[model samples]
Target: MPAIVVERLSKTYFTYKRPPGVWSAVKSLFRRERHEIQAVRDISFTIEEGELVGFLGPNGAGKTTTLKMLSGIIFPTSGAARVLGYVPWERHAEMQRQIALVMGQKMQLWWDLPPYESYLLLKALYEVPDDAFEKRVHELAEMLEIRHVLHTQVRRLSLGERMKCELLAALLHRPRVLFLDEPTIGLDVVSQKRIREFLREYNQRERTTILLTSHYMQDVQELAQRVLIIHHGQLIFDDTLRALVERYSPSKALHLRLEQPADAETLSRFGRIVRMDGLEAVLEVPRELVSRVASEILQSLPVYDITIEEVDIDEIIRDIFAGKREAGALVNTAGS
Candidate 1:
């Protein structure tokens, strides 16, 4: 059975609107105007057990709204969602016990107390057995390399240190499902890599179902093979990360080191010159014509070395989010 299932799930927020003028603000007290913001619109997908899926979108594109609905933090305005076979918005204890939501901007840790105290509180709340809790804490602390700071006040810890503690507290119960939002936000490269390694091992060993949302493309590329992209409050693409590049990216990048200096005008005949420095040049060539263009360049120009590269995943995703390209008519290859 799928670990989570959502059909036509959506959330709309209503907020009061007021004009800029003082008179308009005064008049809006008695006759107020409300605007409907569609945070999520007709979004639907299914995540099978043990699958790690990345949820992606620009700001205000509804990624966090959908996550909130799935985590039972807020109710969806319409549609149905079943997480581990339970309606999330119902706030059932059994369902709550099986899922964990971690948001980078939000904290469950007590600012003034040591993280150990917070862990104890969570242990009692989750009804975790004493022996099991001790084992889990040891394992998680060792993996996160935060054992040294467990007794330190949360407010005094560094951003990376505090994030590690937050993750430990969330996973103390060993929940079956994890909803992660920007878990690596503000973390340095080393900390981000460490966290990714921990998440990879945890998912593989425990088979935890993960739904992750992040602005960092590296996190998605390193951890998730499948990605779901949302735009304008709707799902615009759902497919393997490799397939996303193949379907949307139209050109390949060519880097060439010339035996002799060549001007921009001379390289323009082959393809669009993206950058050039001295004898080195970078060109954007159509995918289908890459080999042909490279051959012609070597035969015609003084070429020393050349390498063809696929478009960067970051660039492709940026284009998709900017509406510069659309996910064409290819069949969805996400579940496979």
Candidate 2:
């Protein structure tokens, strides 16, 4: 069975739709206004054992909300979600034992106490075997490179150090599944890469299914084999990173340089003139029309250097959402 299954799972929050003005606030105070905001809408997907999936979207796009549901932190407003053959919202001990959640923005460690103290408390709460507990702590601390800061008060540690400790704390039980929400939010390049590498290696070593959400494209690009993109509380895409690139990317760019200044009017006919400088110009054109446009530009001007390349996934998705790139179909490239 799949480790996680979410079928038509949705979350709608009732929030007051307050009008702008002091008078409106006074009126709302007495009337108690409310509006239904659908945080997640009819989203359905299943994750297999040990699959690493990236949950991606802009801010307030229900990424965290979905993680909360899977981790049993919050209940869905409608539909159903099951993790490890148990309803997550029910919060049963059996389900809880198998999963872990790490939120980079929130601290689970106590500020007044050292991270070691926090780990001890968790070890007690989870009733981890004494030998296993020590083994796990030492291993994770060494891997996260926080062995030296283990005894330092959580409040005194730098943000990067604290984040690493928090991650270790979340994995104390060696969970079968991990829900990571912005696991490397504010860290520098080195820290972020370290976390990603550790998570990837840990997942492979233990067969731990992982669902990660992050704003950093590098995190998704390097770690996740599959991605689910949410926009306006809806799943806009669910496929491999390559499929997202292929489906939305209809064109490639052609960068050109000429011997001398070229006519601006002549350049417009070749393709969308993205940029131009003196005799050099770049055009965004359909991949199929690449040769045609290049030939036309060459015939029209004294072309010097020219190059064509496939568009990156980032720009392709941008055009797709901006109503520019056409997503006529969904192709699964998870293996690729």
**Winning model by lDDT:** 1
For residues 194-267, what per-residue lDDT tens digits would candidate 2 score against the true structure?
99888888888889999999988889999999998887777778898876765677677899888987777888
Which window of 10 residues has the lowest lDDT sum in candidate 2?
Answer: 327-336
> Tens digit of lDDT per residue, candidate 1, span 181-205?
9899988999989888989988998
TM-score of every model versus the real structure: 0.88, 0.82
Quick one: best TM-score, which candidate?
Answer: 1
Give me the runs in candidate 1 sitting further than 4 Å from their true place: 19-30, 258-279, 288-303, 327-336
Model 2, TM vs. native? 0.82
lDDT of 2: 0.86
Task: Note the residue pairs that clash in candidate 2.
Answer: none
Off by over 4 Å in 2: 16-30, 254-308, 320-336
